[model samples]
Structures are given as structure tokens and as C-alpha cells.
Target: MNSTGRRARILVTVIAGVLLAALATATVLIARRNADPAPGGGADPVAAASPGAGRPGGPGLRVLSNGLLSTVSLADPAGPRTVTEQHCDRAYTAGGTTACLTPAGALSAPRLLVLDEGLRVKRSVSLAGLPNRTRVSPDGRMAGWTLFVGGDSYAGGGFSTRTGILDTRTGEVIGSLEEFAVFRDGKRYRAADINVWGVTFAADSNRFYATVSSGGVRSLAEGDVAARTLRTLADNVECPSLSPDGTRIAFKQAVGADPGKGWRLTVYDLATGRRTESAETRSVDDQAAWLDDRTLAYGLQRGDGTNDVWTVPADGGGEPRVLVQGANSPAVLPAAR
Candidate 1:
């Protein structure tokens, strides 16, 4: 062949290589998108309710009843056996250990009580000067809550709110947050009362996040546990629960004119800061706790105060499946010892 013929062949080869590279890229992209978990995969079933249905369970599963926060051993398929009775808004158990809320009406304060497998209170910590929201860390080593202090009744109704952390081991106050601003009506308003609730901590316990509700406005706040500085993470969010991996937070979003109406469950990606609502959830009242990195458990109430426990996927696809009926303040045991 002549020189020109040789050059033409080379060019043809280069073009073929580029085409193959493009095809390979496209194939990889398709694979990633396919592997992506369905948007709210396990979550969808929980939202769709059917008659005579109950929540799915796994080995060693246990439920802490809401009204009394009673401990029931689910391992016995016959029925849930009561291990203890302690009226708590929330309960968490890990490695045969449990922690719950004991109304500290005695001190005119609420206390978080940690218990062992034998149903004995190991420790009781006072929350007298804190805000209404409280939660214990995943490891059950630390407790976090919100506090409102030093505000006139006019600054967003003159209530002062702050976030606080307590050292469960020593019963010491580790950190507190008081700096926060409330946004409303296209204007930002400053307030002494931050009113943070729905407290959850990252797996590493390095960062903490909570919902700040004030003057009919709700926003998520994140705090650096070491530095003790609080900043708003997202606005118009409530009932925030951190993923087990600490990469995302599951929460409920309000819809329609009334805040209570059109409430939906949504998960916010912490790394990307993108939010997605469950297609299955029509209306949810409050609370979404992570069953795992991929699954979320929460409570939903109909018109009446009666509620049910349900679980959904974080990526969003499957309908919600009821875990239990007439149960509120649902808490999951930490993934195995």
C-alpha cells in the first residue's frame, strides 16, 4: 500500500478505538444506575396498609411499646413477652442493654434512664433545663437534648431555645448550643430560643443534628460535638434521624397550608445535600429512625391519635410495611453486638 493508504488505515484504527471507549463508558454508567437501590425500596410497603397486616421482623427482634415503653421479647414467636415497664417517649437497646426516658416529674425535669438486660436502672440523668427534644447516641454512651433559655416572649414569641449534650458515663454536661436564627416570611429573624428537637448523632459521635422548631418554622441543625458549634443544615424539616452509616438523614416533610396536613417521609443525603420524598408516603405525622443504612422505620397516625409503626427504604421505592399496629415512638435495636 502507498503512504496515504497507510495513513488512512491508522486514522480508521483511532476512530474505532474512540467509539469502543464511548461504548464502554455508556455500559458502566448503565450498570451503576441499575445497581442503585430503588428510590425508597423497603420504605414503600410501610406506607401502603392492608387489613390484618403486621410489620416484618428478623431474628432477635424486639419492640419497646410506646405508651409504656415496655420491653417485649420478639424472639419468642408465640407472643411478645414483657421484660420491663417504663413509660418513655423513646427507647433504644443494644448488646442486651437498653436505655429509656423516665419522666423526672420529681425534679420537675425529665431524665434518661439506662438499663441492663435484667431490667434494672443503671443510671438516671436529669434534663431539667433542657428543651423538649431528647435522644441517646447509638452507642448509648452519650445523650443529647435541646434547651431554651433567656429570651423575651416576643423574639419568635420570646422563647429561648438551645441544644445540649450530656456525658452519660459521668453525668456531666459536655456541650451546649445557643446560636441560631429563625427564617420566616422571606425574612430571617434572630432568637435566643433555638428550640431544637429530634436529636440524633452520627455513628462516630463526632457530629450531631436536631430539628429546631420555632414560631411555626422548622429547620435542621448540625453541631460539631467537639467544637460545640451549631449551624442550620436544612429548613422546613422535622423528625430527623441519621442513617446508620451517617451519610444521610431521614425526616418528615409537611405539605398543604396546615403544617400537619400532607406530611411525607423524606431522606436527605448529607454528602450531596439532596432530598427525596417517598412516593409511597401520602401523609406521615412524625419520627423516622434508621433500621439500617438502607432501611428507615417511623410512625404514622391517622386522624385519630392511634398510630402504627412502619419501615421504608432510604433510596425510595418499595411501599411501607407495617411493623406493628397501635405503636408509636418506635425504636430499633442497634445492629448486633
Candidate 2:
């Protein structure tokens, strides 16, 4: 590996550490998904851009190429990659909109960019903290992000997070989900230490699901974007990702309700309230993405900090396989119909 390759690999390593540290053992029931903190934390070395690098909005898998925005055909994920100028710590696309979280830099603060289907920035907002996770609504009207604001790891209960929401249509931005009113068991619930993250919006764009932690309990909370309210639905659900059909949620549940024991990838049936464990039994820590109604995709880090995008049967059958290599964040772009 040359200088750029070495840097990219090292980034892969640091990013893995960032993810692990972001949700290590003995946590505060924190919510958020994945860790793809930029290439160099603050700044990145110049990338060796290749010929034929172009726009990445076609039906494909959009991912970070050592922190550079890149894409690969869903049919041939291991094939040639189309690189873009966008550099982000975390990225996600939904309903023709892309959310890019730039890393907080030494000279420049981190920011969020809302982009159109053409990958053109429609809006950009300055932000604070380490970019942890980001998701756009299915209709592309809403976007949310999570940041590691304080401390390094959750193992010592030393980490904190700030999650925010943005309404692209109205140019409205909620700096933190903490501003919203939370309710549990049909009453207003308030805690001195409340954190919310990993927002997965519903089709209506007005309603969404996210992990809301209060009183050291993480619950899968449903939110009303218009009312700025979140109602607890279930407990011990972190980084909830609502399925495409809206009938199920893919989340990470800590082993034996202990974060130190690591988390197991599980799916919950909304209508039935039954849980199904995914086939990949490793200590998965990132928020999962639904490939369809029956398949799930997420980033998994190796012991050495190398990362890869993996997929498995969401129905709790079959085995897990690497969908893309040398990638941490995986967002599936709708294949051109």
C-alpha cells in the first residue's frame, strides 16, 4: 500500500475504533448507528482520484471510499468503484436525498449537507461533534444525525451524544432531539440525562422511529415530527431501523441486556412483537439498513479495525456475506426503474 492506501487503511482502522468506542460496554443506553468518522478525523490526505470518476446516484451501493464518497453497482459490489468529491464521516440516502456529515475539523467545524438525487447540495448546515450516524426520510423531506459530543467510550459511562433533525423543505433544523418532549406509558417523561439518535423515518415523513435513552434505559421511540414528541414503544432497542414495509424494526440488542457482553443483531415484528436474531452472530454495533423487506445490510468491523459491508437474511435464516469490501457505511441507491 502506498501513502494514500496506507492512509485509507489506517482510516479504516480508526473508524472501526471510533465505532467501537462510541458504543463500548457499560454504556448509557446510547442510541446511534455506525461509525465512519472521516479519513483523518479532521482532514484527509489528497485521494488518488481515478479516471471515470463520476456522479453516484444510479441504482447502486453508495459507500465511503476511505472517507471519499463512492459507489458500486449493487449487482457487482466488488467491481470498479465510481468515486465522488464528497468526503464524509457518515452518509445515507433515501427518497432521492443524501445526507453527508463532514467530520469536525481543526479549522472547520463538522457540517451536514442535504443533497438531491443528482448529488447536488441543496442545503448545508454547520454542526458540532463527531459525525456518528445520519439518515434521510423515505420521501426525502426529513434528515437526522447523531454526534459524539463528549468523552471517548461508553465502557466507562463517559460518552455523550447530540442528535439533530432537519426538515429540508422548510429549512427547519432541530439542534438536538433533547428539545423534543418525551412520553412513556402515556405520560410526559422527563429525565435530566436524555439522549436520542439513529432516526429512521416512516413513509409519511412526519413520523419516525429512533432510539431514545432516558434514565439509563434505551427505548425504541416513535416520533411525530410536527409535534416534536416521542413516545416510547419498546425497551432495550438501540439503533432501530424501520423496515421498508414499516411492519418490523431491525436493531441491536445487547447480549443478556448487558452492553459489555456485546450486542446481537435482531429484528422485531411490529405487528407481532416477536424478535428474530440475524444470522451474523458477531458483536455487531452499527445501525442496520433494510435491503428490502427480507434482507438487512450493515457495517461490521474486524479486530484490526478493517471494515466491510455485510448482508444477511432479515427473516432470521441463511448466512451473512460481505456485500462490499473496504467500506464502512452502506447506503443502497434505488436501482433506476
Candidate 3:
């Protein structure tokens, strides 16, 4: 071959090698992108897109404001972002699901909304009375709510409430506790004035705890969702909130005879029937939310007619701390892990 032809062949060989190197580099880059982990762990590209996915469980506090829901980071509460424009009287979030109580209309009944991870309403049910307390089970299978009926008021005492449970998976709703069989002192008691509220479900979806008031006396009672029965555990314990570990419950106990001024925070052990008062002396009438196994969070009304979220030690020892200001009815948004 001539010298010019030999040089042309060498140039073509160099061009082919450069093309191969570029293709190999592009393949490695594509593999690395595909292996990128999601927010929790899997390769679900939509996981990070979900609201409250990357947020911390205990600190990502969402509270109700002017009937709307707002998300505020307890670590930096100065700037709050409103997640939804719709009004929610109260809400509870767990395991990528949120259950909110929204007003349906001026004269119509209220509603219970089961929201998706993106804060969109997936399912809703019409509810009666004003929305007071709402909660979702840890596993996100069941949701419960307490509403003031007839004469109950959220800001004052001397009222009755109707509590209900809903199976999110089956869309089955237990409208009232009146349908459940009640056993007082190991005997079945059927009273017309019986009222129930403040439901806290156990880790197992079959069992739950609530305050059953009959004959003007309130008592802590455990219920079986499958059997529709309740057995009185202890008396004078109202608005019970189960702990994260399912070992104890944080509730409000009347001091003596006056249920209005006597409301105080108390922790009751489920295994052994023992109640301990917390360091807080103020009247905490709201259903407490367990931030973790050791911390209990609740809403405390200020003198200006607004409420703020406060935290106290679940063991009833440490001083109270303000978790978030200008917020009420706190529900912890658990991070996807």
C-alpha cells in the first residue's frame, strides 16, 4: 500500500477507538442513574415526589389553622407552608396516609377525608356533629374520630361526644359507640345516655381504647373492633392517646369532681393499671398525640384565643416544651423509612 493510504487507515482506527470509549462511559452513567435509591430505599421514582416522604416523623408537625392544614417543621417553625386550601377541622397522619375532618357545607353534615400521601382526598364520608379529634392507626389500616354532638363544645366543658371507627381498607364505618356492647364492672350495661369519644387504637387493628361515659361518669374502656365490645379498664380517664410502643396511654383526668377546671394530663399504663400525672398544671383538654415512645404532644390554648402545640415527657417527669407555635391539633408526619 502507499504511505498516504496507510495513514488514512490509521486515522480510521483511532476514530473507532474514541467512539467505543464514549459508548462505554455513557453505559456506566446510565447504570448509576438507574441504581439511584428512592427517598426510603426502593427505586420508586414517585416516592420522593410524595408529600411528607423525606420529612422526619416527629418533627414534621402539621397543624390546623383557620380550618386549613399547614405543614411546619418544628426544627425551623418560622416559615410555614400550607399544604392544602381546603378546610380541615382536625387531622391525623400515619404511614403515608392522612385522615382529616372537613366541613361539608354550612347546613349539611361534616366529612371525614382519607387523604393520600400527596394530601389529595382519596375517600370521604359524611359525618355528624363538629369535628373534634381525629386519628389514624400506626399501620394506617384504621381511622377514628370524636365529634361533639348535642351539647359538646371544643373550647368549653359539659358536653357529649360521639366517637366512630372506620376501616380504611374496606370503607366500613362504625358510626357510633352505641352499637358496641359495653361491660361495666364485668357486667353488660345498656344505658341510653351512654356516650363514647377519644378513640386510640392498638398496634393490632382488632383492639382499641376509648373513653366511655355513662350516667355522667367517664371511664377508660378497651374495645374490640371485630367483636364490637368494650370492657371498662379504669374510671375518670378521658381522651386517651396510646403511646407509640402500645404500653401506656396519655390521657386527661379530672382532678376531683369538676371536669371543667380539673382536666390534667395523665399517663396510664396498660399492663398495670397505674396513672401518673405530668409536670404540666394547666388544663389540657385536647387528645394528646404521642410524638414518640417518650414524648407526648398536645394543643394548649393561649390567652389570645389561639392554640399551640406543646410537648411533655411521657414518663411525667420533664418540663413541658413548646414544639410549634400558632398551631393546634398537631399530627406528626412520619418519614418513609
Candidate 4:
């Protein structure tokens, strides 16, 4: 054969091989994409972002599990539509941030995780005891958690609680409320038995309310985040939840005279100093969440060992109504804007 003809045949052979390789690569890519549907297709959109993500108002309810953080539509409330993989024993979401508490692996230390809008962990704080109560401020600037610690005489309510607050933006932690100057009955008192837990933040995020206990007596105290001071408001109150309007506080008040037996859901008006008890006759032991300006929601323990979420009028007029079954630690996730 001539030299030119031989060169042309060689070129054609190489071109054919290149085309076949390209086709094979495309086939493998398609198969791999089909095998992994995480970003699309069979994936849950709410797990990623909801339609409200770009809208002005579409917040939904979120529930926590050992392995999943499930989200349910507020308007629907039937079944969970989306979920993110998490190990939160308890969780609270607000202002586009979700904070959760999960057990530290292979150790007794617990961890509080601050998650972003995509459900990604932004911060992890090592805690000292079993996770009890977790909350975030209305503005989401502050996060707080309670853990069950052992060793105090007044901690006989099963376990003592260690409460801490965090400023997520600044990464600052107020690990102990005991550091604050506590005023009781208009007088400053110092005692070694001071323990604070079940924090509820105000809308401004600078003021908070929590249960302060000493010598086995519990009281509701208002705290100033900036001043770092606490003043007792009333006795026999635990787990205080500030109303949405910030005018009243819904708290668990010791029923009759025995605090250990349980508490009653009561609302105390800050302006009038008036207190009213909810219609729920059962002893509630959990912090209450304000569903609206007039409704307060809390957890009630049942005989089956499971807890249910119930709501009552903030003014203490109507009977308690069950809102969510088999769930506890209620928080009203506001509409996203």
C-alpha cells in the first residue's frame, strides 16, 4: 500500500476507539446517577429546603428522633414529608436555626449541636450530663440546654439539672446560671445550693426566665443576659415559658403543697401579678410552649410512660386539648419569612 493510504487507515482506527470509550463512560455515569437518588428523584424536598425557603411565610413543625429530624407541614400535620439524619434526643428550631442534643458516642458527655437551615451542624458543644431540656430564643441568637447531673441534695428529683446558654453568633457560652447575682425577696443571697434549669428566652434575647432552686425550694426568676443578674418573681414555679407577647409567663406551679408529686400549668401575668391555673388537672412536669398569644402548649405524662403534647388557653379558660400524640418538648416553630 502507499504511504498516504496507510496513514489514513491508522487515523480512522484511533477515532473509532475514542468514540467507543466515550459512549462507555456515558453509560456508567447514567447508571451511577440512578443508583444514588439523594439529591433528587426519590429524595425528600423538605429535607433539603421547603417551598417556604424562598417565600415570605411558610414555617412548619419539626420533630426529633434518635436517627432522624422529621418535618411535618403545619397545615397538613398528617405524616412527615421530609427528614434529616440526626441523633437528637431533643430539638428546637427557630429563626432559621435548629439546635439539638444528642448523646456523645462512647462517653458520658452529651453534645448540643447547632444546625443551619440545611440541617448541617454549625456548632457542637460538649455538655456534662444527660440531655433534659433544650430551647432557642425567638430571634435564634441564643441557645440553651439543660442536663441532668448527679450529686446535689436538692437534686433528688431524680437528677440535678445543669443549664447553660450559648450565643451562637459569637460562640459564647454561659455555662452556669450560678454565676449571676441572685436576688431573693428583694435581698441578694449567696448559697451553695443554687441550681438553675429549663430556660426560656425573651424575644429580645437579652432577658430570660428559668427555674432557680435552692434548699429544695424552686422559684421563677427573670435573668438579664447582659447584666448577668437574676431576680426572683414567685415561689413554687418551675419551667417558665414567656408568652409570645412577653406579657405573661406560663409555668409549672407546684400543686397543693407537694412539689415532687407534680406541677400544674399556670399563667402569671407580669403586669397585673395575677395567676391563673389551666384546666388540666393532671400534674405536668415539662416546660410549656406558647402556641399563640392566647394558647400555651406543654407535655403531659401518661400512664403508658409516653408523653403527649397538650394545649390550654393562656387565660386558663378552656380544657386542655391534645395537639400532638406521643411527643414531648413542644415548641412553636414560627412561619419562615
Candidate 5:
């Protein structure tokens, strides 16, 4: 064929191939967007309900799991609506919203996933370092999490833990507590002193607390939420739970020298600074929740990984009653609207 005719034919072939490829890509994207189930069928109704299914004032527990954050109504605990699904290790809720911490991956650095009440990913904040044990402030204005820097030898994983507070609105690092000393009643406590975990904030967001164990001695720290200042309340403790009134704290304690043998649930009066053990069963790794100023809720694990939820009186009386199964991290709603 003539040179000009051959060149024209070659150009036409290339253009047709490009158009075909573009059409195929578009088709795949359209299919993926519509693949999400609609209402009805075996799909979860709560999740199928628009992106804004659960609003700010709704009755549900927002939980983070395997990088996906979802909400389950307290009334219907099993009905969960996945709001955000990313590769995250943990999730927490504050101020009627949810936040997730992404795990380190090949292509992406660790980040914070913030979601609205409707289970929609609203924003993503890149974190400078790896984060662990994340908690949100009660006011929803601030978020705090522990960051693990260089490696150290701790039983769980690392020795050095740095706590950072971030401004949720601006995504700024507002405060951090890196000092390795434990201060109690205006005195510097030693670092080799306590094993801390389960860090959380009070209702007012003014104070933060954690479960600390030292040389068989266990206690709770009532620290300045903003300044990171700390003061010890009591010792010989396990998982600690704060009451809604902020006037009391509940925890589990080892009844004998060998805590691994088992533990007993206890309550502490913040005002009087007294620790009282309950008549509850002896269990390890138990967590307690305050249903109210007088009522407490907790979970007990059986020989199997399955667990039973129970409730007792904060005043150290009454028999332990069952609440639910496979339930953990119970935060009672405000009497249900």
C-alpha cells in the first residue's frame, strides 16, 4: 500500500483501541458502585438505609472492627451498619461520631479515619507516627492516642508509650505527655512502677484515667486531661471503668497473691478514696461499666473465648445478674430518647 494510506490506517486502529479500553473501565466502575445492596433482601436494613442512616442523636454503639467502623443500635444490638471500611486496627467514638486508626500497610502510612454518624467517611488525617490505644474526648473536640516510638521490650509490645492529644476540628497535635514519670498527689512516681492500659477520658473531658499495675500493686490515675497531669486514686486494680457521674470508678482486683489465678470486681469512691470489693465471681481480664451511680455492668470470659455480661450494685451488695452475651465495652446511653 502507499505510505500515506498505511499511516492513516494505523492511526485509526490506535484510536479505536483507546476508546474500547475507556469503555471497559467505565463499565467496571459502574458495576462496583451498584453492587452494594439496596433495601430488602438478606442485606442489613440499617446499612442499606442511606449514608446518613443514623444521625447525631441516635441509639447505637459505634464500633471499629478490622478497619471497618460500624454502628449497632442498643435496641437491636445485632443490627450493625458499616459506616467506614478501611484497613484500621481500632476504632472509638466521641461527640456522636466515630474515628478509626489505620494500620501500617505497604503503600500507605498510618492515618486517622473520622466518620460522621451516618457511617460515612468524612475525613482522613495523616499521622506522623504509629498510634496505639486511641481514645476520644467526651466533648468530641479532642482525640488522644498512644504513639509507639523506637522499639522497646514491654510485655504487650513496646516499652515506651507516648500519649498525644489532637484537635479534631483542626487536626492539630495540641498536647502530648512523654515524661516517663508517674506522679501521684504531687509526687514523681517511677516508670518501672506501673503497667498502664485502658486509658480513657471523663464526661467533662477535663480528666483522663488509666489502669496501672506495679509490682503486684494496681491503681487508677486521675490525670488532667489537658495538661496530662496525674494523681493516683487507689491501687491493686485491673480493668477500670468510670461512672457517668464522674464521682466513682469500678475495676477488677486480684483477691489473692496470684492475680493470674483470678480477680474480684471492686468499686472506688472518688470522693472518699475508698476501695470496696464486690461479691462477684473471680475472673481475669474482666472489665466493669457503671450503669448509673449505683449500678455496675461487666463481662466475664469463660474457658472458651465467649463471654457473659453481668451487672451488680456499686455499693457492694446484691448478686451478680446476667445482662447479655459476647458484649464488651458497654457505654450506657442517656436513658434512651
Candidate 6:
């Protein structure tokens, strides 16, 4: 062959090699993308595109997608969440009421919001301290919230919580449960060091349960709203959440009655007066919600301060499982509760 013909063959060979290398690189990239690990442990669901801010939330599992109010389907708890524009440090919904606790700022105090199903704020009450937990009564006629009123950390044993309730139907606010008279040991209980948190209401709205701490001891107190009274039921019970059936209450019991040692998720039978520890075996500093009468769901913080929701059996039988990733303050809606 002549010199010109040899040069043309060399140019074609170099072009073919370049195309082959590009094709191989593209294939490897696609494979790596497909194999990417999920957010926590299980498979991460592909997040749905943001529907923009302030979308209405309906029936499903209500959660905080980051700090915004969001919802995920109960049929698919680990699926993509539908985020909203509303921001809250904690949130809950049931019956027809949706309660949200807004994050506090340097210049502004935290606020509690009662939003409609369309994500519109119906009523808002300015609150003091950091937003901690909130719950709506089964009948949706009442709402309650807990705030870190004093100290910096709960585990440090210097913290105090203020829990309050609202009569949503009458627009009457019980600013703090402290105003209610509580009886201990069959006598009137009044103490300067009383602190209350984690209010969970029964189906009747007038009855509820909470963790009442006074003089360094915490007990589960059953409160009567009309009478403005509280009756101590059990000791070492913190953050009580009533089950749908009214037969059991789930709470985080301080491990060995010591706050520094962590807590065990426990369920108390109202009739039998028996407490059953859950299988989670991890410290859950949260007010658990019932996913029906048999299962309970609560938040567990990752090492980085991010959160993932986990579920365990109420009867203390099954192992713990991750229900939703990057979410907290779970509320199962009308269909279940």
C-alpha cells in the first residue's frame, strides 16, 4: 500500500478505539448509580419531585420531611414522602385535627399551629421554649403539646418540660397542665418542682395520660380535664401514648428507673397492670404512636443527629424494623386511628 493509504487506516483505527473506551465508561457509570446504597440501612425509595411548598396533607402517615410537614402512604411506609411548605419541629394528626409545633428562632418564640387538611393554618398559639412533641385526641376535639421549658438537655437530668392542652372545639386553652390538681398517695399533691410532659388523650378527650415529674421522680398521671385533676397511676413511665382500643398505653420507661442509663419502650395494660418491654432494646427518646393496637412506631436518631422511624410490636414479640427514613413524629391517620 502507498503512504497515503497507510495514514488513512491509522486514523480509522484510532477513532474506533476511542468510541469503544467511551462506551465502556458509560456502562460502568450506570452500574454504579444503580448500586448506590440507601440513606439508612434498607433500600432508599426514589424521592418524589417536590410539589413545591405548602401542599395539603391528607390520609396517610404524617411525618416531618426534614422540618416540613409531609405524608407517606401506610401501604408503603418507606416510599417517597410528599413534602409540604409548612415547617414544624414536631407534628401529629388524627380524627380531623393536625397540630404542628413551629421551630423557634432567635427573635421569635415557638408557636403551635392547628392546620386544616388543606395545609391552611386555622389557629395558632405562640409558645415559649423549644418544640418537643404534640398530639391530637382521637376525636380531634383536643390538642396537646410538650416543650423543653428549662435546661439544655434531657439526658443531663437538668431539663424541665411543660405540657399543655387545648379544647379545640371551644377555643379554650389549658396553658399548662400544672394548673390541674394532682393527688398522690390519696392526698392532694402540690409541689414547686412539678413538671409535666407527653400528654396523650383518650377517645373521650376529657381523659388523658402524661408523665408528671415532681422533686426528681416521674410517674404516669391520668388527668381529668373537666375536674382539673390528675391521679398518679404508675411510676417511671414517661411519654405515654394511648392505644386505639383504650386497653393499653405505650411509653418509654427509664431503664432501671435511671435517666442516664437510657429507656426501654414499654406497654402497660390498663386492666392487668402489667408492663411489657419491647424488643427494640435501643434508647427511644420519643412519644410512640400506635400503628393500630398491635404495633408501635417511634423515632430513633442516627449518630449524625438525623432521624429514622422504627416500629416494634406492642406485645413485646417481634424484632424492630425501620418504617421510614429521615422522618420523625409519625401520625397514622383516620383509617387506622
Best by lDDT: 6
Question: What global local distance difference test value does model 4 have?
Answer: 0.75
Model 5 error, position 37 (Å): 20
* Order by TM-score, highest first: 2, 6, 3, 4, 1, 5
lDDT of 3 by residue, 1-337 (tens): 9999999999999999999999998888777544432112323322323465224453577777666677766566545455455467888887667778876453346778777677666677778887888888888889899888777553344577888888988988899977899999899999988888888888888899998887768899999999999999999898899998889989999878458566889999989998889988898888999878888889898998888888999777989988877778777775444
Q: Candidate 3's error at 285, in angstroms?
A: 0.8
lDDT, candidate 6, 213-324, per-residue tens: 9877899999999999999988999999999999899999989898889999999998888999999899989999998889999999999988988999999999999998
What clash pairs does model 5 have? 67-88, 83-119, 218-235, 218-236
Give a tens-digit lDDT track for model 1, residues 2-48. Answer: 99999999999999999999999888877754432222132211122
Q: Candidate 4, residue 109: CA error in Å?
A: 2.0
Clashing pairs in 4: none
TM-score of 4: 0.79
Q: Model 2 — TM-score against the truth?
A: 0.82
* TM-score-better candidate, 2 vs 4: 2
Better of 5 and 6 by lDDT: 6
Candidate 3, residue 52: the lDDT equals 52
Ranking by lDDT: 6, 2, 3, 4, 1, 5
Model 4, 1-337: lDDT tens digits are: 9999999999999999999998998888667544321221223223565424322355566664223466655555444445555557778877767778875444235678787666666777878877778889988889999887875333256457789899988989999888999999889979987889889889999999998988777888999989999999888888888888999988888866467566788999888889999888787777788878898877776887776667788776989887766666555565664
Q: Count steric clashes of candidate 5.
A: 4
Tell me the lDDT of model 1 at 182: 40
Q: What's the C-alpha lDDT at position 202 in model 1?
A: 72
TM-score (all chains, Cα) for each model:
0.65, 0.82, 0.80, 0.79, 0.63, 0.81
Q: Provide the overall lDDT of each model, using Cα atoms, as 2-decimal numbers.
A: 0.59, 0.81, 0.78, 0.75, 0.59, 0.83
Q: Residue 94 in candidate 3 has what lDDT?
A: 79
Q: Lowest lDDT 10-mer window, candidate 3? A: 37-46
Clash count for each candidate, listed in order shown: 37, 0, 0, 0, 4, 1
User: What lDDT, from 0 to 1, does candidate 1 have?
Assistant: 0.59
